[model samples]
Target: MSNTSTSSDTSGLSAGATAATIALAVVGGIVVIVIAIAIIRCIQKNKMQARNTSMQITSVSAVNVDSNIDMVTIERFLADIVKERPVRFTTQNIIDFTQNFAQKLGSGGFGIVYKGQFPNGVQIAVKVLHKTQDKRAEEQFMAEIGTIGRTYHINLVRLYGFCFDNTLKALVYEYMEKGSLDSYLFDENQKLKWEKLHEIAIGTAKGIRYLHEECQKKIVHYDIKPGNVLIDANFSPKVADFGLATLCDRDNSHISLTGGRGTPGYAAPELWMPYPVTHKCDVYSYGMLLFEILGRRRNLNLSQAESQEWFPRWIWHKFEGGELDGVMTNCRIEHSNRDKAERMCKVALWCVQYQPDTRPSMNSVVRMLEGEEEIIAPTNPFQYMMPFDGSSSQWSESRGYSTSTATTTNESEANILIHQNQQ
Candidate 1:
């Protein structure tokens, strides 16, 4: 009887052990399934955010735009982002393939650009935007790639690949051997010659014209300054930063804030006006850029103190009298080149006319620059008042006292344009 009882006890213990093992296995399987679901949700959430960029802009208020964000706020926003996808480089994997390729060419708000080579040994410029915290960054990354990808022109910069991952957001492009026209023109050391400068201006005008007329979509290169103009090995000018504004705008216009998106000197007067700006504003900016290139001067700091200004009426006197050529003439600006200089100066003076209607389109400018026909002399520019800052001796007697400064100093989609010192 005692032996039978012991056998029953051992059998019961074995059964209990088996039941416990099954329970443990069931719990482990459930945990794995839960983890997988969570990861999938995270990825989907990120992708969804990237697609809907307008929501982020909608979240902000007009009243709060001026007061809402500062360095601290931006810092907090960056910290909140959780990276889920890492950038996947799709360039060729072979060393001989992408090696001589992807050489770090330059760096900007976008990450460092790499020179990339394909299996066919094609050369391209790659601008890699620095990795950032959240979906906003990813949206910007994709927006630039998507917008620029669709836009193709011999004069416009080309986009190849955009890496949208948890760790990276980079752009691949066709490399421009010469950097920005701003560097070549204003770099004091390597300033271009008269004929080359003339060609650059003409090429740039054609590029801008193509954006306005030839492109499938109407585009306004809001930032049409020297920094954004690139020259190829053949000295052909191509417009970079082509689709930048649209990228930040989520591919639409008619936004709440438009005033402070461009450089101070190059920005249109409408940029400071109360009404929302439009494509005409780009025409105004293009005008300023044209003048800056020909004048060989930076207009932003033309008058720091009211007393230190050299402006509109003064410049007009110089231009109409044909003495404007003397002002921009350095060693590079010569007597033999005076005729070309005068023609460009006349064109420059005409471009910055105060009224939008008075300004010519880039297409017209291109034809004029290409020497297609003789350009007409400009009418007198409308006189305007700028609020003065107590002193007015250094400037002309016709100083307006407008002290307001137009600056889109803090913007995401806007360029980080600084006050470049003029010679």
Candidate 2:
């Protein structure tokens, strides 16, 4: 009986052990399955992250490709230029020439200019262009190379070479020791003689004439302010800064401009308006420049009296009133320069004529300034300021002049008409 009882106890103990082992196996299997699932999910997550990173990289590459398109165009243009001019320089060359950009000469909206020297000790002005999102820097770079790169003139600034690299872009120019013309015109301490100023005016006109009539493609120097005129050590003027310049086929009667391209006071009215523009727009800007040169003051100066606030209007008033001598005296013109000053004043009036066709060609301007061509008395350039009355020989003072009755007349008659209208 005792043996049988012991056997039953042993059997029960073995059954309990077997059931516990089975339960443990089931739980272990579940844990292993859950771990496998977790591992798979983690792998998928990693793959998704990698795909997203690749997509982002592709998007960036697409933008780079677009940018590269412009770069390629510029490179091709430069490559062609290089074949003829040998004016291409590497980024390392730029660094060497500019000595790591040690000497900063000036800074402007475009970028900084550094004084540089070559291996042979020839000095240069390195204009490093600002990187812009709008690609204006690139456009200006192309314009300078396309226009001035092909032409050479005594009065035009010389572009020595250029640096176009993946991370840098710059223009190398001949250094002008005397600096820009505005330094002399605006600074009282840096005064130039009237005779010298007259010569500069002629030189500038000749440069413009060359651009207008001589170049294979007519280049309109959209910005012709005194700031763009550089003076050499000998005080010779050279037209510089062709960033705003545009080239048009000579056969095109009017050039299509996307937008205005000059300083406010110097910009032609037609530039702001939706009018058909021609190289005559440059003539208009040059006229504004002449007014500044005549007074050695800005065209628009609020510091002066109300009548004298706009220098061009003041000159017109004095000129129409037969007080041009007063105008000359006010400008402190030398006695010997009175004739030259008068000619400049007349040329300016004609240049600013409301009708572009009435304005003389730059060739005629050169001739007139040199006293080789006759300057017919300029009709009122500011006729819009004084409207004419068709019923009578007078201009309407209240509302300004009528365009229909505007006619070309001699200086004496135009002055009389203006005086009568004032009365």
Candidate 3:
């Protein structure tokens, strides 16, 4: 009996030891899990704080020169960018590549572009900025470097490198063999296929949409035109020239600018007024560009035949009159492309709506172009007039401005009359 009791006691003690070991392990595991979660939360909080601080510093630095940019921060940002991008070239390097700047591409408001070929036989377009004493050139240089340098898209022009030595500043980009879309679209002999034009339009829209919605920051191109749209060797459209770009927080609906930016005819009508601008401004310019692509002519060709003096007006007249077949007869749009062509016209009209609110987002524009969404007929863009001085004489004296009269129901006719009156 004594031996049996001793064995039972030993087994009970062993069971208790095992149970205690497992309980201790469970407690230890719970503690470890809590520590890991706490660490993760603390790290996330620190990161959020860092981002907020960086944004605050950037906002302040933009307005105050005394508050110098965080060089360390900029260097880090540039370091990450350089990790995957081409290195910055010296002015001498650019000169060597360009053969002493021999082949000039063209000049713009900011600078001249020259075609350059590297020793490796790779070609590039070197945009040499015009030296300026004012802050405009510096602002533009910084804007382009900061915006385009960080962005990468097949539809967006690629900035291979840049140079900022002494007074010489330049941006080197991928060489576009076909040149600007503006050059070919209007060439009488170089008529682009309707399918090709449609592809160009959709590609351009995707690029803009990416800028507005996909980028880390919301970028308003502010200038979307045929001149800014470069055609690659494959005839694909690439959005270029970020000189007029403005950045805003992604969550923000609109941004306020002191003054308007963009080419006159292509600029949104609201840009002339004191209003907060949005990515919609780009939409308006794209609308104007779409119209030009469809018409195969400049929107404001005052010297063209009377019917086509203002391309938008002429096209609008055709659209309203249900004469879409004759709208772009010169382009030789085929029966299959007729629907595509008409959809382009409808989308263009929607984009150039008098009110920015009425315009569809670029994403929506893409869907309509892709035939995913039904396009509604846009209202007559000119039926709604810009609020000018409330007198016809003042309107008449304004040269190109006109009043809304019942007889002038057609906006195109009104613009035609204005052009004639000015002449």
Each model's TM-score?
A: 0.62, 0.71, 0.70
Model 1 regions more than 4 Å off:
1-102, 133-143, 247-259, 300-314, 328-332, 380-382, 385-423
- On the 0 to 100 scale, the lDDT of residue 187 in model 1 is 67
How many backbone clashes does every candidate have? 18, 5, 0
* Alpha carbon lDDT of each predicted model: 0.59, 0.77, 0.77
Per-residue CA lDDT of model 3 for 20-66, tens digit only, reads: 99999999999999999999999999999999999899877775754
Best-fitting candidate, measured by TM-score? 2
lDDT of 2 at 137: 55
> Which is the winner by TM-score between candidate 2 and candidate 3?
2
TM-score of 1: 0.62
Model 1 C-alpha lDDT versus the unseen true structure:
0.59
Candidate 2 clashes between residue pairs 3 or more apart in a chain or in different chains? 386-401, 387-400, 387-401, 388-401, 388-402
The most accurate candidate by lDDT is 2
In candidate 3, which residue pairs get closer than 3 Å at backbone N, Cα or C atoms, i.e. clash? Answer: none
What is the lDDT ranking, best to worst? 2, 3, 1
